[model samples]
Target: MTAQTGYQDHKTDRLARLRRVESQVRGVTRMAAEDRQYIDVLTQINAATHTVQEVALGLPDDHT
Candidate 1:
């Protein structure tokens, strides 16, 4: 699903969303470093993965 238009107006919003995903990834790294329980770490990893996927999927929609 390629977007036919550019997201010029949504640049700020898209960047903000990416920043949030980056933060989520950092949190996951911290959890692992802190020796968190396996399930807890896995849960956070899943959440981060889902967030990234959402952002990726939104790109084409937003551009359109």
Candidate 2:
């Protein structure tokens, strides 16, 4: 793909990943409010972070 196309695709992917991350964060908040285990909540947060990182790493640097 051309640089422009690549960047556009990257932006779309990043936005989608961010939406999922947002939901995961909300889930974590609800879990906390419900007195869920700290470790479990942290695990979910970690997983979300990892997923975001993977998506970011897969994107081309020029896309940023």
Alpha-carbon TM-score of each model against the true structure: 0.73, 0.69
Candidate 2 segments exceeding 4 Å error: 1-6, 59-64
lDDT of 2: 0.82
Candidate 1 per-residue lDDT over residues 16-46, each given as its tens digit: 7778878988988998999999899888778
lDDT of 1: 0.80
Clash tally, candidates in order: 0, 0
lDDT of each: 0.80, 0.82
| Tens digits of per-residue lDDT for model 2, 1-64 | 6435565646777788888998999999999999999999999999789878877787767455
Q: Between which residue pairs do clashes occur in model 2?
A: none
